[model samples]
Target: MLDAPSSSPRLALVSEDPLARGALARALSDQAEAWTVVAAGTQEELEAARGEPPDVVLWDTGLRLEEGAAPDLGAPVLALVADEAAGELALGAGARGLLFRDVAPGMLGAALHAVARGLTVFEPGLSHVRAAPRSTAPSGAPGPDTLTPREREVLGLLAEGLSNKAIADRLAISEHTAKFHVNAVLAKLGVQRRTEAVVRAARMGLVTL
Candidate 1:
């Protein structure tokens, strides 16, 4: 569940670029009233967030997702990405929101508000780049390329960042059924993780955000 927006909502900005970090801080500060914007250039600084975690963490996509990493702050993460592919990867890696670095003031403010409400946001008109064709059997059967209509529906919801419970509720199916469908989708996509499945489905044009 999302936290309620208090009188003063804290926002955390994480970026390595000095100019970009400073500019983003100022922009967010002016984005809304009583917004406590905190800027951090390093992971250590972000880890040391005072009181409860910030309402949201806006990070630059240039910072690679380190292996075995966990969420540093207990807030929804909004990533600054360069393009569609990067945005998809950020989503796959569990960033709740995506915005281009050259975003306008209105869009930045809107993205922050949307992400704070526990909604996933991606840059408009972003689509996946075509991936290499998957190897098929000698008989030319569709190997992992064919998903049932129901599985396709589940895939789309997964791309939207819905949990099993939410997907079940949205699809009018039991939670166990939702889990089964999700596992089936992952297996058919030849991926081990939910994010990888979403990325592969996007590459295949099976779903869009």
Candidate 2:
């Protein structure tokens, strides 16, 4: 399917588990017919399947790479991880997007297509790992030190693992406004994902988790 140029984008699914590799391939073929899907059960199969390279590589967390360096493959990568911490590791390994292992089929297809189009996505509900270093605000740490009172509230709610809708209901704010506050909190905390913001808050002694 990857041999020639065509309208549909080519994608490679890499996983050690035969079931996972098969399921993802079936989902892409069934839900995302616009994509030409290929499956690889091992690294050797993955390398062999890459004749000209596909538009994207959806790889399982089992794959590892040195920090700050990407896979030699020319295509962008979307990693499947067990949790947000694993997701962060994958990103550091140069994956452009992350999908949790239990993601729904529709989301899996959509995430793949979006990453193929050059977007970096982290699945909702997967936040930063708490094992990150603690923050030391010596009367001044520009990033986490700058969160406003409202943003701090949002961060607290985020730490509670509340979705935007739940946060809005609790605070009696519109969902759009809740989303805005959440994004603002993330920006001030210097974290990319919601869970990361919560972790940062805990590290900074800003939230009692």
Candidate 3:
């Protein structure tokens, strides 16, 4: 009952364990009819599914990326990790949202809905996402650099490794308009390259990865 439209808001369900994958799939399948899922047991399957351009992916953080793979789906990626540390690792690795593996089945839908709308999700108490990093700031570093709340939303998609084109699609802006925000981000971070900016912005607590 799923159509593979190149522009549809399809979802890719990714997990290594059959039971976990099946369970997550069942949880997502319960959402409204527009949400489609492509089950992927491996990163290879994940990347292949991305060619169809799903709007969001429900990923288990344990899936390994092939060397030189972008290391994540270019679309919104919601990671189901084992703990807050695992969530941090996934975020640092370019995931856009994190949920505990034991997230309430209802929460699973809410989190996916949020991620698809280009919003971040954090489990409670585990919700350290809004706070700028607390680790001691590196000498001469600007930890806790704050962005206008608007820029924060832009940066959230940037952390996902999306080209301005992809980000514009998610945020409903023209590519030229998105490029303007990106240039603004580059100037603010004093960095080149999307990955470098994300690493540094997150490291310095300027932005939550």
Candidate 4:
């Protein structure tokens, strides 16, 4: 992968479907002046590659949103979803921007740049799918103070889509210990899965996707 210059915002293109990922990469190929596709792969592959995180992650959520599906790539995410429900789920999962899968190449480029600049972008038609209100925590959710400092660190790692072994390496702890901390974070966040915990934390303002 080519390293993007500071003047060129780096982008990571992620999609579970290889064909979709290839098509998007091709679409981005001509936009080198605006941004660079520094990485392209499934989330797991990207995580395993361990490259520098991109400025924005363009994730294609095909056809529908899967249960507990979320992209936590340690950068702002611009999700390409199929419909309103998928768009809403993307926002709830901490995606900073959303667009329909059939977005024009030009519009897609604009959305990527907007998201990289810390602006939320959404297809005008899907404007109704907004982030959850920050004023109120999810019902029955614990306060932010519930997580210990170490657990908070683990939570941050989880948001980055790190595996337990990767988290252990980063924190200099045993994999078993990392797993323990991960479980603790999920429990404290009142979530049964890592994706759910990340979504809950983002909604709660505990972590900025």
**Candidate maximizing lDDT:** 4
Residue-level lDDT tens digits of model 3 in 5-55: 344366777665778788777776675635667446655456555566667
Tens-digit lDDT track of model 4 for 139-193: 6758888777788898999999999999989988656458767877887777799
Q: List per-candidate RMSD values in Å.
A: 14.6, 14.7, 13.3, 11.2
Give lDDT: candidate 4, residue 101.
95
Write the candidate numbers in order of decreasing lDDT: 4, 1, 2, 3
* lDDT scores of the candidates, listed in order: 0.69, 0.69, 0.65, 0.80
What does candidate 1's lDDT look like per residue over 106-193, in tens digits? 7777777778778877767553432223222234322444776677788989999999999989988656457767877886777899
The TM-score of predicted model 3 comes to 0.51
List candidate 3 segments past 4 Å from native. Answer: 1-8, 31-34, 48-50, 62-71, 129-209
Candidate 3: count of backbone clashes, pairs at least 3 residues apart or interchain? 0
- Report the Cα lDDT for residue 144, model 2: 51
lDDT of candidate 2?
A: 0.69
Q: How many backbone clashes does candidate 2 have?
A: 3
Question: Candidates' TM-scores?
Answer: 0.52, 0.52, 0.51, 0.61
Residue 87, candidate 2: Cα error in Å is 0.9
Q: Please provide the root mean square deviation of candidate 1 (C-alpha atoms, Å).
A: 14.6
C-alpha lDDT (0 to 100) for residue 128 of candidate 3: 83
